[model samples]
Target: MQKLKWGMIGGGEGSQIGPAHRLGALADGHFELAAGALDHRPDAGREYAERLGVAPDRAYGDWTEMLEGEKGRSDRIDLVTIATPNSTHFEITKAFLEAGFNVLCEKPMTMTVEEGEEIVRVAEKTGKICAVNYCYSAYPMVRQARAMVQNGEIGKVRLVVTAFSHGHHGDATDADNPRVRWRYNPEMAGVSGQFADCGIHALHMASFICNDEVATLSADFASTIPSRELEDDAMVNFRMQGGTVGRLWTSSVAIGRQHGFDIQVFGETGGLRWASEQPNQLIYTPVGGRTQIIEKGEGGLHDDAQRLSRVSIAHPEGFPLAVANIYCDLADAIRGEIRDGLPNAADGVRSMSAVHTAVASAKDGGAWKDARPSIFK
Candidate 1:
């Protein structure tokens, strides 16, 4: 089997997303961490390299330099994993794609729809593998939900509901971690704070499971905290293109919650509910029967879900392992193997549009409009 050598663009010391990327990449063994440009800070980058045991010569202060210098090395890197702030995704990703390196990037594709379109253009123009880290798509139970819905096991999807809230310490005075830094900075995070940060994931989860996109939406949003520049909380209502009504409440200041990304898809015959906190199993309830707790890596699941569920049932698989599925699948794609299910730039564009629509609607007093169309198809 062809192997993929990996490099990281961010996840330096004290950064939240980077280490998560590193862990996911390492978890699957299909890829190797051969090089990295962990942070914009040189000292921090070096320290991260040491901590990761990456070679000093392959580490650099900038991702561009690493990409340019490594281009000719046959054994260096086949794929680049980006964990940078929202503002840098477009430019950095374009460079890497044009350089013929596959990419697995963080969500909220780019800061704007135009940039998102351009990223899709380049990825298609290059014919190289490009994927976004929508981790829920990797969940075996999530796959089961998607399969059941698409295969008519749930009949027509009636409504989809998702709730993602995180009462983060970012806005708290007593607790200040670097993880909350980019989140509070509008320059780095762009417009609509925590919604884009984590809401993007929830949006993707809902759509991925139902196999649809938002047609129209209305939203209510607030910063909550007086001094903060970004929205700490929001409420969004929408209808997917196929007439499936939906509602979402994404917040960073919802007290008593921690990284909550949960969804429920209701259809004519039955429904399924899944939560990020509990990735190991999915709740399936029939119209007249009791709710069946469907566990991953078990019998009676779709072939794709079974293959991705590498760990045995009861051993448990959550956030990190979900990401590992993406890592392994993308690596397989990069190496010229075809995987059954993997989220690509097309998923990114729809998610980007959903997020932009939610933000715009909230800003306009919960006004409704058609969500932006995907540029991929």
Candidate 2:
């Protein structure tokens, strides 16, 4: 199969996520970076595009120009990845989908639930694939865990606990610190701060692993730094559609935990545990039985897990490789293959709904609120 031609929006020079997307999208050589509107500034955009080896003519100053330029091109990009800030995702994604391009966008797909719904509607109307970068779902162990739960290896799921903790934001940021100002600013990061940034991943991980929808939830949020406009910590309690209990905690202000993402699911007869810090191992225990550690790419693993494993079990694969899996799956999907386990527009909607509900629950003094998964349907 031919490599897909791809473009990007945002991810200018020095931006964290943009380069990751580029590297991940091209990791397997299934895609080529054909164009991009890499920055808001014309000079910067052109420079950044050149830095990525994009042809000068293909690089545009802004998304509008990129869309307009690609519209009339004989060799148009097959897809565009949006690595921009939260506030800008809706317009960029909607515009691309309307222009007949598939989109792979960053999570919390839009700033608001309404915008997410609109994106979903446009995607369905256009018959274009819209994937959200819920990259954790791409991890081999995560897939293995999901498969184990689905195959009844753990019996009926009874409870789940997930968390994402980081110490990067533990100290208050100075207004002049450009690195994290947008994240602390509501204008850029939307209503929920740490939760929107990392909590959504936790939520998605649970849902993806359990194959269940979060039915109702209550949340509490707090900003450790007084100067910040949004919360740096969030705690949520919820019930899944199948009556499984769950709790999620996302905190950027945690003093000692750095990227401490972990999830443990307990079922009627046994339990399973996986942590992001150690992506290669999965711990499973049957009732009254000894614990077993499952390694990625090892024998006895599910085919889904083995398929996602890029290298041998001992050879580690982390975030970038997980992202590459999504990109590869997108390429398969584009080529008319049955792509399972890829997060699509509906997942995006459901995730954003979880965010909105969690924020609302926090605001309403921790009252239980519905996540409204029905919106995806």
Indicate which candidate wins on lDDT: 2
lDDT of the structure predicted as candidate 1: 0.81
| Number of clashes recorded per candidate | 1, 0
The 10-residue segment with the lowest total lDDT in model 2: 172-181
Alpha carbon lDDT of residue 206, candidate 1?
79
Error of 2 at 94 (Å): 0.5
Per-candidate local distance difference test: 0.81, 0.90
Off by over 4 Å in 2: 173-176, 373-377
Residue 96 of model 1, lDDT score: 91
Candidate 1 per-residue C-alpha lDDT over 87-139 given as tens digits, one digit per residue, 9 for 90 to 100:
88888888999988888888876888878888888999999877988887888
Residues 1-377, candidate 2: write the lDDT tens digits.
68899999988988888767988999999999999999988889988898779999998999999999999999999999998877889999999999999999998789888888899899989999999999988999999999999999999999999999898877764533777667778877888788889998999999999999888999999987888888988999999989999999999888899789999999999999999999999999999999999999889889889888889869999898999999989999898885779998888888888888998999999999989755644
| Candidate 1: worst-modelled 10 consecutive residues by lDDT | 169-178
